[model samples]
Target: MRHFLTALLVMILTAHIAIAQSQPVLNLELANKIADAAQEKATSENWNVVITILDQGGNLILLKKMDGTQIGSIEVAQLKAKTAFEFKRPTKVFEDMIKGGAVHLNTMPITAVEGGLPIFKDEHIIGAIGISGVTSVQDGIIAEAALKAVSLN
Candidate 1:
């Protein structure tokens, strides 16, 4: 009876470990959710903007440049998202650092400009989202909406 109980406990612990390993990471899902929500809000507001989602590794996850948005905005948004993900900081924050004479922005192979935010999940950095076109301020507005939609940081 004692041997059987010990084997049963081991099996249960193994199963739990396997389940934990099988859980999907949150970056992709958060990116898709952010992009979809940004697009929905932009459409309703007639605000043409490019939304970009990038994983923590700076890889593109999703992108949407709304109709009427400038073609160049797409690349800009991508760069912004990539910058935020790679640096794990908001692109605007990097820009501010540059303005403060950080002089480090040039060394990074990323755009340290506005329109990017670190996508957060429970205080963890999962990915990032960026917005462009219209105005820089509007970019923040849309991106914030996306974050709020997903209840992410």
Candidate 2:
């Protein structure tokens, strides 16, 4: 019985490791492309926004702050990106949930803002993008534009 239990545990651990290893990792090149796309969108709209790109594990891949953007947006943008990646959904979803009376959601260590979105490719979340220093809706628009660009790649 002891040997059987050990073998079962090994098999379970091996399968978990295999699945994690099979997931694609976000590279600097892709992060740059996403940031550039968001930058271009924000510039075209005359919006000075801070853009943050984060990997699937919620690590910062790249960050860019447009001129005239507020300094506070830097941290806000990073937090937004982290929230999106960690939660595997757009930050707006959390915000909406809280507004609907799920107030306990605020206790979590995440920024439930509309500016953050997960970047998906082939139905898998490859990374995330967050934009700030604009209205929450406008920030979401910029992140969505970046996501679209990433999808086309």
Candidate 3:
């Protein structure tokens, strides 16, 4: 009976370790790296923007606003990041749905615009990034470039 109990304990520990390993972690270092990349891209284009990063649990990890960027973009950036984190998908999905006549999505608690993208590691979402300033398409481009720069796609 002692040996069986010991075996069961080992099995439980192994399972716990496996579950922890399968979950992706997002830390400040990674979030800053992503934000830096986004800033660089926006700067290169001479565009001022606001960037927001959120952890998987919908917690704000980082927020950056370039000089001369509109103040309103701050909230928009946060909303986009929150939407992405909450939905575990890019905000563009909602925009696409709306374009396809899913206007009801606008009434939902989502930004429903481009520029929000989920950050993935090993096919699992770790966090999300959102940018606002220029056009929606341009914001999306900046977010994509940031993800690619960090190799977090």
Off by over 4 Å in 3: 1-16, 20-22
Which predicted model would earn the best lDDT? 3
**Model 1 stretches astray by more than 4 angstroms:** 1-24, 27-30
TM-score of each: 0.76, 0.82, 0.86
lDDT of 1 by residue, 61-107 (tens): 78877888999998899888877877788888878888899996679
Whole-model lDDT, candidate 1?
0.80
Candidate 1 lDDT score at position 122: 52
Candidate 1, residue 21: CA error in Å? 7.7
Worst 10 residues of 3 by lDDT: 144-153
lDDT of 3: 0.91
Q: Please give the lDDT score at residue 122 for candidate 3.
A: 75
- Residue pairs in candidate 2 whose N, alpha carbon or C atoms collide under 3 angstroms: none
